[model samples]
Target: MGRMGDATRTVPCDAVAVSSIIETTGLVMEFPSTRALDGLDLRVSPGVTGLVGANGAGKTTLISLALGLLKPTSGGISVLGLDPSADGPQLRAMIGYGPERNVFPDDMVAYDYVRHFAQIRGLPRDEARSRASDSLYLVGLGEERFRALGTMSTGQRQRVKLAQAIAADPRLIVLDEPTDGLDPVQRDEMLAIIVDVNRKFGIDVMLSSHVLEEVERICDNVIALDAGRLVAQGSLDELAGALGGVDVEIVEVADRRDSIDLVAQRLVAGGWTVARRDPGLTVTGENDEEVFDAVVRAVADSGARIGRLGRRRRTLDDVFTNERGDSSDRPSTARTGGTE
Candidate 1:
């Protein structure tokens, strides 16, 4: 009876506090041939969190579990203080999920489809209609809201999905590849809309995207998954600190071509590793202060003056690509478009 209640209850015994919107403990998911997730533990705070991973890295699997669309083979998941598997319907009511695929019904009008979703989420017919119209306009589809879905371009259809997702006024919006298949301008517009959704409405967002640049630009924190395991999770600064201790950039040498070797030798002599760049050299150290001191010492010893010297920050690409694992599925998500 106790076990039955555990399986049936909508709320987790250890409820999520204000600090975290989502938490998973020792999460595991196994298929017949492959383990989609392995002992994954994750915590998500408010604001925009980016879910990043190479294809087939179990990013989609994690998303599915969070939505309670797939029961985990082992582990527990809590969203908004509710057990996803046990209280899936209740949990999903507060979560707006936009899938990567284009599964919209072609014949229906955009506004009607969004309104239909709002109603399905338990809104009254009148309120759903009102919210749907407002959401479509908010997503920049107001002028075309009455148009048939089939008549819209890929970018427009993507906005329709966003409109429907927000129609119910959910607390958390989970967007998978929201910018996929969009042109540069469309992508920028979509990213802006995503930012506005969180800031303007006070909704938490989990963006699952392959574009590292966009994620870096919009996300407050990032979770990196690889081969069914969580390899990294933190604010961008924390992840960068863990991966790259400190990178000192030396620029504007008297003669870059000839000074590169001299600078590298000087830094190496100072017990620091140095990598050459076209316009500068990147020196590694234990921390910023230590790196700066070393850079000063190295420059003094080498008698080389630099126009600019500063600590360089690492990018998402640097963090993702430098991770050590069997990333055979790097392109798997690209091929599947994370549809599953």
Candidate 2:
């Protein structure tokens, strides 16, 4: 197979032309017994955004509506400045999507599969062939382009899915669980390709995944949903900084419990809100510097040495836990139709 040339490196025109990639207003999708999305209002800027939610949180439903696969029960949605329901064909021509499931023809070779989708997107036969080769190369499957998908490993098959999604040079791509089923190294490689797709091609990306760490790693913004409702949306820094505090760990001593208790008492006396965490305590204050000073004073007064003390930077996992509470036991009522 021929390698991708400079002529085939064209980027989508709409990548820079559009400001908001996706927008929804009062969107609702109801099934027979459960409502998938409830009055969701969202506006996503042009960047790599992570769509986060638990099982049956209407993530799949929202993606379907955005891609014009499913009409909303009520309200409106816009993609690339076009109404998805009204201009689905035109809109889809400018966008690409990779669903969570493995839906591939066993007998089809990688190049043919991607080229077929490129032609379906209206590319000429020659351009489609060039694009298919280029996309496979982009996903690190160039050498395997002629291999039957059935003969490929799970990681290679996933790369083929990604190659097809980008074959037409779409302005935006929606990926659900792009890193699923891959081992650590494969997952890292897939994530790097995703970042390259957005950074190098300027294609906006909306990634939906159960792995918050991967989301945190690759996304510029995040949209969190819960029980079919919009819970949070913002940049990683914004969401993490909202829950700022200090974590203080006491030096382990024969009487470590007593030392921790002493420090906690002193901090509480200093008007700090203290919470017990294993091996130490978490303290919050109106001012961070003041909190740090108080912690120092408390340790000094208690005569307990400090093991570790630092401002706690909250992770995406922490943000999710704090926002969603203990909803782990809540049964999923929303119908995802085989997607999460």
RMSD in Å for all candidates: 6.2, 6.3
Write out the backbone clash pairs for model 1: 55-333
Measured with C-alpha atoms, the lDDT of residue 34 in candidate 2 is 96
Worst 10 residues of 1 by lDDT: 331-340
Superposed by TM-score, candidate 1 places the C-alpha of residue 94 at a distance from the truth, in angstroms, of: 0.7
Top candidate by lDDT: 2
TM-score per prediction, in order, is: 0.78, 0.82
Error of 1 at 31 (Å): 1.3
Give the clash total for candidate 2: 0
Candidate 1 per-residue lDDT over residues 1-340, each given as its tens digit: 1132323234221233467878999999999999999999999888899888777888888889899889999988888878888877777878888999888889999999999999877687999999999999999999899999988998998999999988888888899989888877788898899999999998888988766677788888888887898878888667753444344445544555455567678778878878877566777777767877877777666656675676676776666656764444443222223211
